[model samples]
Target: MSDRNPGMELDLEWVSRVRVNTQAVLKRAQQIQGRKLVKKQWEAAWLLRAVTCIDLTTLAGDDTPSNVHRLCLKATQPVRYDLLKELDMHDKGITTAAVCVYPSRVADAVKFLKAANSSLAVASVATGFPAGQTPLETRLEEVRLAVQDGAREIDIVINRTLALSAQWEALYQEIRQCREACGDAHMKTILAVGELGPFTTVYKASLVAMMAGSDFIKTSTGKETTNATYPVAVVMARAIRDYFLRTGHKVGFKPAGGIRTAKDSLVWLTLMKEELGDEWAEPHLFRLGASTLLADIERQIYHHVTGRYAAYQELPLA
Candidate 1:
C-alpha cells in the first residue's frame, strides 16, 4: 500500500541454490550478542529506538475486549510519560510502531485506537496463525476478513509443510495469493523457522516470501515450541541482505517470540544495524513482535533515567 517493496516474480532456480553455513551463522550470532555493550547515555538511546520498532502484541486464548483495550492504551504510550520526560524524549511523541492482535480482535484494536485518537496501525495474524494448516481458500478468506475489519497490517503464516517439502513454487504462489488478499494492508509472512528444519531452509523460505511480495519476513509466530533465536535471526538477516542485492526491494525483518528483556531489544537492534544498515533499523523495516518485552524496556528506561530500579507496578501492563 505504501509502495515500499512491491514484490516480484518467483525465481525458483535462484531460490533452490540458497545455502547457509551453520557454523558461520552461529559464530556471527555469538559475536553480535557478545559485542561491546552500549553503555550509559548511548544505551538509553538504543532502547528508545527499540520502543519505536515494537509491534506491541497480545495473542492468547482468553484475549477479551477489555484486555485488548488495555493493550491498545499501552501501544499508544508504550513508555510512561515521566520516563520519557526524564530521558528528554517526551516531546518526541514516541509510541510503538503498531498493535498486533488475532484476527477476531482486529476491530477492537482499531476501534480503541480511533477512540483514543491515535494513529497506531493494527496488525492481525491470519491464515491459521502459528500452524497454518487450513485450506488455502480458507486462509485467503481469513486475510480478506481481517482487512475488511480494519486491520492495516496482516501477519499471515507460511505453510511450513510446503517449505519443509522444498515446494518452493507452491509456497511462493500461496504467499502471492495471501498478498493479493491483503490488498492495501502490508503483508508480513511468518516463516515459523523452528518448524522449517535448518538455517538453509529458513534462508530459502525468507527468499521465497520476499519474491512473492511479503512486505516483511517474520521469524516466528510466538506459538512454536522453539521461537526466535540469534542463530536463526542471523540466517534470516543474511537472506534479506541477499534479496536486496539481487532485487532493489528492501524487505523488512521481524524476530518474534521469546524476545524478553531490554537486553534482548538492544541485541536485535544491533543485529539490524550491523546486517541491514541504519535504514533497516526503523520501524518500517524492523519489528519486535512482543508484549512482555515492552515492560522490560520500560523498566530499563526508568532505571537508566532515574538511576533506580522500577517497581513491577511502575511499568504498565503490556
Candidate 2:
C-alpha cells in the first residue's frame, strides 16, 4: 500500500464553496474522448500498461468460490503467454493490480491467490457496497470483518443521503469511521457520483472523502444507472489535484463502471497523464475497476500482435 492519506481535520470552509463549470467539464470530456494513440506499437504498449492497472473484479450476486478462483487465475495470467511473448513483455511480471470481490468472498480470493503463489492483492467491497444504506455500526463491522478475512484493500461506499442533504461534516466523520475500521488495508472511497446530485456535489464529495483518509476515490459501484463518465471524472481529477497541491498528499483516482474497452482504458490513462501527470498512471495511483474490460483489452492486443482480430474462442474468458 502507498503512504496512507493520514487525513486532515475536515475543513468545512473548503467543502462549502466548491463549484464545477459544467460546460467546461463537458468540453474537456469531449477532448479526452477524441484523443487517439497514433502508432500500433505505441497503442499496444499503452494497452499493456492499462492491463497492469486493472482491479479485476467480480461483484455479482452469483459470485461463488469457483468463479472467484477462475477470476484469480485470470488476474495472475491476465494476458496470454504467447501474446506477451509477441510483445517481449512476458518477463516483466505483468498482472492486474488486484482481484476485487465481495466481503464474504474475501477469504476465497485470498486463498486462491495464495494457492497460485501469486502476490496480487486481494480487495473486498465493504460497508454495504453499491448501496451505503446500512446502519453505521453495521458498515463499520462489515469493514472490520473483511479485513479480518485477509483483504489488503477495502472499497467503501459513502452514504449518498448525507452528501445530498449537504451533510459535509457528517459525511467526513462517517468516512473517518470507515477508515479507522480498515486498519492496515487501503481504503477506496466510492463517491457514486451518478447518485450524488451534480458535478459540484461530486467535487465536494471527493474532497471530503480524501480529507477523511481515502487512499483512492472511485467514481461508481457499477450498479447505478449511470456509472463512470468523463465529465464527472474531470471534476474528481481536479479535486485530487487540488487536494494534492494543498496537502502534498497524492491520492488515487478510479473510474469504475461503463469503461469496458481497450480504447476506453487508454483515454483514462490520457486523462490521468493530462490532468495529474505520469506518476498517477501507475498501478499504485490509478486503477481501472472492471470485469470484462480485460477480455476486450486482450483481444485488442491479440489483433495488434497478429494484424487480425481473434475469433470468439481464440482467447480464454476473463
Candidate 3:
C-alpha cells in the first residue's frame, strides 16, 4: 500500500505555477488505448483485479436501505462464485474496494457490511456532493455526520467556483477542514475536472487537493456533461506523481463517470501502471468510480470462462 499523505502547507508557488501540456497529455491518453491488449487468462486476471479497485456506487435520489443492502452484498461478492471457481480464484476472497453511497445511506451500508462480517470500506459522498454548493458550515457538518455514521472514506467535491476563481488559499483551507472532520477516515477530493476549465487548472487543483490531505484525487462527480476524460485523468496522474516525488507521500487517483466496459477497465489499469507505476494500480491506491462497470466486467469474465457471453439475466444484478 502507498503511504498516507498527511498534507503540507499550501504552496502558492507550486499551485499557481502548475502547467499541463494539453497536446502531450492528450497524445499520451490516446496511446494508452493503443497499447497492446491483455488477453486470455492474463486479461481475465486483470479484470478481476480491476473489480477489487472499484468503488461500487449508488447515489440516486431514490436510494434507500433496501438497495444499499444489495450494493453491500455485491461489494462482498462482486464476482459469481462459479465464475471464480472456473479461474481457481474463489479461494482468493475477491471483493470490491468499497461500497459508496450518499451520506444519508452511510449507516445502512455500515449495518449491512457488519452483518456480512466483512470489513470492506464504506465510502460516503459528503460536502454537498455532485455540486458542492452548500454553505461551508453545512458541508463540514455533513462530513462529520458521515464519519460519525461509520463511513471509512469521504469523497468530497471541491467547490468549482473556488477553483474557477483561483481561490487557492480558500480551497486549500476548506479541504483541510474537511480532512480534519474526516479524522481517521480517508478523504477523496473530487476536482470535478469537466467543470474546472483548462488542463493547467486541473493540474493545480490536483496539487492543492493533495497538499490539503486528500487521500485520493478524483476526476469527477460523474454528474457533468463530460466526465472522467482520459486527458483530464492524465493531467491528474502527473500531479500525483509530482507530489509523491516532492513529499514522499502517495495519493490515490479515481476516475468516475462513463467508465463502464471491461475493456475500459483494462485501459484504466494500464494507464495507472504506466503513469504511476504498479504501486498505484492496487485497490488501495487506485479506484474506478463506477456503478455499471462491474456488470460488464463480470460478463467479460463469463465469456472468458465459458467461451460464451452470459445474458444479463444470468448474472446477479448489482
Candidate 4:
C-alpha cells in the first residue's frame, strides 16, 4: 500500500511537469517574425521607386495672387493647362501617380483627372482634422462628408488626448469608430507618432492603430511643425511586421510630411521595403505625403523611360 501511494504521487508530479513544458513550447512556436531579410530588401527597392515619383507642394502657395489662384485652380482642374503645355513640349514629366488634395475639392479634382494616363487620389483629413478632439459623432460625419465628396482615401489624426493620457482603451475605441465611419474608404491612422513622445510610446501607438483596423499607419500630419522621421517610420514598420506574424494581417505604412524631393521619398520607400518586404510595395500598403514630390519623380521616370533630362519646373503645374 505504501509503495503504491508513493508511485501515484510521482505520476501526478510528472504529469504537471510535462504540461508546463508543453505550454512553453507552444508559446515559443507562436511567436513568428513577420518579414524575411531577403524580402525586406526587395521591398525597400520598390518603395524607393514609389517615393522617387512623388511631387510635393504646399496647398498654400507663395504670397502672390496669380500663384495663389493657380494653386486654387489646380486643385480642381482637369490638368494645369500650363503643365500640359510643358508635357507637350517634352520639357517636363508627369509623376507615377497623381497629387493628393484636400477633401473640399476632391470631386472637382477627380472630375478633371485624365484617367487614361495619370492616376489621381483625393486625401481627406478627417475626425476633427488637425486637432482630433471632437465628439465621435462629429468625427464620423467628417469622414462621411469627405467620401461623399469623392475622396478615395481618408487620413485621420489619432486622438492625441487619449494617447497621451495612456487611455489605450479609448484610443482603440476611437480607431475602431473611425474605421467604421470610413465605410469603403481605406483608413490611414496617424499616430502623430511624434506627439506620442518616445519610441516606446510610438511603438505602442503603432500597435493600437493596427489592431483597431487601420489599413495604413501614418507617421504624422504635416500640420505639425515637425513631421515624419526615419526612426519613427522604422519603429512603426517593425511593429507592423510583428503584428502580421501574430495575426496574419498585413497592415500598410505611410510616412507623410517633409517628404519633398524624389530622393527623400526613395529613402523612406527603401526603408519600408527593407523592413517590411514586398507586401508593402503597393499603393494599398505604401504612400508618401507631399505636394511637390511628384515633379521630381516625373523627371527621374522621364529620364529613365524617355532617355532625357526633364526638370520639374518645366512640367505642367496642374
TM-score of 2: 0.99
lDDT of 2 by residue, 44-141 (tens): 99998999999999999999999999999999999999999999999999999999999999999999999999999999999988899999999999
Least well predicted 10-residue stretch by lDDT in candidate 3: 13-22
Q: After superposing candidate 1 on the true structure, give the runs of residues whose Cα lies further than 4 Å from its correct spot.
A: none
What does candidate 3's lDDT look like per residue over 1-318, in tens digits? 456789999999888677778899989999997999899999999999999999999999999899999999999999999999989999998999999999999999999999999999999999998999999999999999999999999999999999999999999999999999999999999999999999999999899999999999999899999999888888999999999999999999999999999999999999999999998889889999999999999999999999999999999889
The predictions' CA RMSDs to the true structure, in order, are 1.1, 0.8, 0.8, 13.6
Question: Of the pair 1 and 4, which is ahead by lDDT?
Answer: 1
Q: Per-residue CA lDDT of candidate 1, range 265-289, in tens?
A: 9999988999889988999899999
Alpha carbon lDDT at 97, candidate 1? 94
TM-score on alpha carbons, each prediction: 0.98, 0.99, 0.99, 0.70
Which candidate ranks first by lDDT, i.e. highest?
A: 3
True-structure Cα RMSD, model 3:
0.8
Give every collision pair in model 3: none
lDDT comparing candidate 3 with the true structure: 0.94
Over 4 Å off, model 4: 1-48, 51-99, 114-119, 301-312
For model 1, state the Cα shift of residue 24 in Å.
1.0
